[model samples]
Target: MKNLHTRRHLLKTMGSGILACGLSGRSWGQSAESGVYGKRAAEVMAHTHENFWLKKRDLYKGAIDKDDPDFIWGGGVMFSAVVAATRHDPKYKSIMRKYFEGMEVYWDTKVKIPGYEPSPTAGGGNDKYYDDNAWMVIMFLEAYEMSGESRYLKRATEVLEFVMSGWDEVGGGGIWWHEKHTGDSKNTCVNAPAAVGCFRLSKFCEPKEAPKYIADGGKIVKWTTKTLRGGNSLFGDAINVVTGQVNGGQLTYNSAMMLRAYTCLYSLTGEDIYLDEAKKMGVAAKAFTDSKTGQYRDSIKWSHLMVEADLELYRWTKEDYLLKRAKTDCDFHYEAWKKEPAKDLITNGGLARQLWLMADMETAAGRDFWKKSDKLRR
Candidate 1:
């Protein structure tokens, strides 16, 4: 019994040591390559570029389709443009134009109100996902910043007006996750981006009203802290007042979204609470990553969520560790797909994700491995 107790104590100590190491930033992977930062940036751009083409062909019928909410297609465009800006690639500009064209159609057809419909046939086409629109607006605004286009900014403002329409009295003040009949479900995924959108939008709008955006963002952050906590950490999902629970499972994407929101809030207000939450979410996300293999598991789909988290952490903290892990995880997933052809592994989305990671890795490491079709490029 004494020996067993001793073993348990030793294991506990080692575990604590590992956790401390992770928090202290010593355990985060560091690349030894020169020009790693630039290489990873370029690699990420290339990957996004490839994914844009693949997703366009397979997911959206060769162009930004108008059958669905503009936000969905807008997200792909936004993500692609972000990569393009980072890498200074011109192809992304063309992709952004396609996305903008789709949004123009959506703006023309969508009811000029504060809500959106997920689909045309569902719920009288009067519903909207708050975060979806919020993220779309953010993407558009960023695109404007990158390209200096006034149309993008105007469209983004219009979307923001729609997003604010969903704000109601619920769990303090948070944007409803959805706006159809199920507008009561206020998940972190929806609210976080809403808060971020409000804060970011204020920067381009009137300064007098900027306080309102800041206040709204603060309220959402507070509500998230009060309602989204399970034990001492953020809940993987939440129960909506109208729809009960939309997402019961922990998703790496959701977590990263939350991180993005928190970081935006921190940047806007210079608040410590937002910064603290970002760090906590960042660390919690680290657990989803395989330390031995450096692959991030998709907590919801069993697919790798490394790319999402990598981009989130990179943008949030500008830390090299997150980028390194992203590269390693991409390499692992690519190799796995090569060895066994799973359905998910063979999809355009999967390949695009892999290529994006590889490109980002190369950009950061300043190494060109696209020519070599080995484990790195598999």
Candidate 2:
């Protein structure tokens, strides 16, 4: 009887705290009416940005290798710049410049396989992964747009060519996942990034300059949609080449990639279907969240899908609910990190991703900070 009374008292105290924070049921409604959601969302994004820069600077010292998927570091840089641009940050441009410079050495290097040992001894080996090349091109194109640098654009164009070389009709006409090790198997992961690459490429490539690429991008988008839809409408992380059986388990990371691809396609074509698909994916991805901790598992049940999806969602939609959820998730992870900051599985990469998300979110919200920095840049 005493324990039950204690539990009730604790519940009452917690409920009172919620009320005090102005986060109680009625307060949430009033806050939304007064645009509190937007304000809070921005705050969350700003917090994310500060944390990301601090962590990334500590982790990386030199240029990341282009050949290894694990070493594909340009995406974070590009994402950071995007958030910076959204907030109008000046430092973002400098960070972007550094990232571009680090990646510039591999601009002319031949495309490498997606998952192969990086050779320090050999100069150019042929283990080209389509997704890696596609993402790299996407990053370069975004950087070019942010900086108006012809060099970034030029590098993006070159990378696009390399990415296109892997295009072959497999799994009913879509981009192959990998080049060196290829069969009929296809994955949305590869196709989505390729679609983004093509969308970005269209911006710089003229009808006369690279008509084939423009056409190829359209075909790839069509193929990706058809393949993804034919199987489940919701994409699988990967597919078996010979059997054509899709691995239907949903992953938060790839879903965001697909959402971005669809959104980009919508941006290019003004198609309602693409936009609708993006919104649908956004809604579906919400299921990835853990209500108690607010963190997203890497994959739904089996795969340890990390915080990457949370970052992607925050990037895709500036929705307050998503931002709040991301904040809670980041808080949960950070608290966990405090306990064990260096545990390989839970710490290094996971913590890095969590911090990146936090930084990205904060950067998204730091509009005033960005304006001040932009003024300094001028």
Question: TM-score winner among the candidates?
Answer: 1
Find the candidate with the highest lDDT and give its number. Answer: 1
TM-score per prediction, in order, is 0.67, 0.63
**lDDT tens digits by residue: candidate 2, 1-378:** 453343234333323221221112321122123333234333433443343332433222212222222234333333433433433446556655664554443433443422211122133556556676676676666566556789878877776666676667655576676766565567777777776676556656653443344456556656655555433345566667678777776666566666666655555444456556666665676677776666676522121222443334334344556556655665665566456443122123334334433443334343333222222110
Give the Å shift of residue 313 in candidate 2: 7.5
List ranges where model 2 is wrong by over 4 Å: 1-70, 73-95, 104-121, 182-184, 207-214, 229-233, 299-320, 338-378
Candidate 2 at 372: error in angstroms? Answer: 18
The backbone clash count of each candidate, in order, is 24, 17
lDDT of 1 by residue, 33-74 (tens): 434434444444454344343443322322222322323533
